[model samples]
Target: MTKNFDRLLEQSLDELSVQYKTLYHDSDIEGMKPLAHVDCTVLKIHGDYRDTRFRNITDELSSYPESVNELLNRVFDEYGLIVSVWSANGIPLYAM
Candidate 1:
């Protein structure tokens, strides 16, 4: 399962990177960066530019037991963009 998840994460990150790059390019934002932090990996889009930040929690999915899903759901509902889950590779797993 972990291996499958890792592959998924890698794919997701690649997709997200392309998407973000397009967004930034279209917006013509020179210094814009999309920062994402999952449990173990930190992925930064335009990391050198240091403009925007995105916090996601997909990394915690494996650690959190099924019982905590309710609590996690609540957090997602309440925080909106404050918390998210990303895959180990820092691809967004869930966004709120």
Candidate 2:
């Protein structure tokens, strides 16, 4: 990826908490809340828990970085709350 895209991706990940809050507000479930903290792998993958896999996040890290995504998926498999993105039903659509 280009330097610009890298920076954009970094910014996107850094702002995940904010983006999550906004999305969660509109689709907040009874028992679901945004994650208070995230891990290094999660941050690196740039997975926003508040983002829905089924929806389009025009202003966020809508997609995962390839090199990181696969590796992150393994981490997710082990413990799927690193960057846990939930659906309306509270199912984790993707956790990296």
Candidate 3:
């Protein structure tokens, strides 16, 4: 179900006026370094829908993976402003 959701979200992202990058894996973390101020990046804070490592448990959300931790630190320290939104079944990652 979430796989299909990811696809739909991907489509919506495509329709957006800005460019976006999905940050869910090491490759994604590495790939984000080159993003200019114009780029829109999606930090899938919980995890990727397709990966088994995707965090959906209480313990998992309590501590992020190393890559995710680094990425989050970089994101929080580098970017002055951040925005996030999710609908329908969305339960925010931070609430856990």
RMSD of each: 13.9, 14.3, 5.5
lDDT-better candidate, 2 vs 3: 3
Q: Model 1, 1-96: lDDT tens per residue?
A: 121212344466586663323221112333434223222232232222223322134563245434334433543475433445667796988865
State in Å the error of residue 72, model 2.
2.0
Cα error of candidate 2 at position 33, Å = 31
Q: Which stretches of candidate 1 lie over 4 Å from their true place?
A: 1-4, 18-71, 79-96
Candidate number of the best TM-score: 3
In order of lDDT, best first, we have 3, 2, 1
| Pairs in clash, predicted candidate 3 | none
Local distance difference test, candidate 3 = 0.59
Weakest 10 consecutive residues of candidate 1 by summed lDDT: 20-29
Per-residue lDDT over 1-96 for candidate 2, one digit per residue giving the tens place of the 0 to 100 score: 111212344466567743422212212322334234333322323323344332235654465446445544644576554344557797879866
TM-score of each: 0.20, 0.25, 0.59
- Can you tell me which runs of candidate 3 are displaced by over 4 Å? 1-9, 31-33, 84-96
Report, for all candidates in order, the number of backbone clashes.
Answer: 6, 0, 0
CA shift of 46, model 2, Å = 4.0
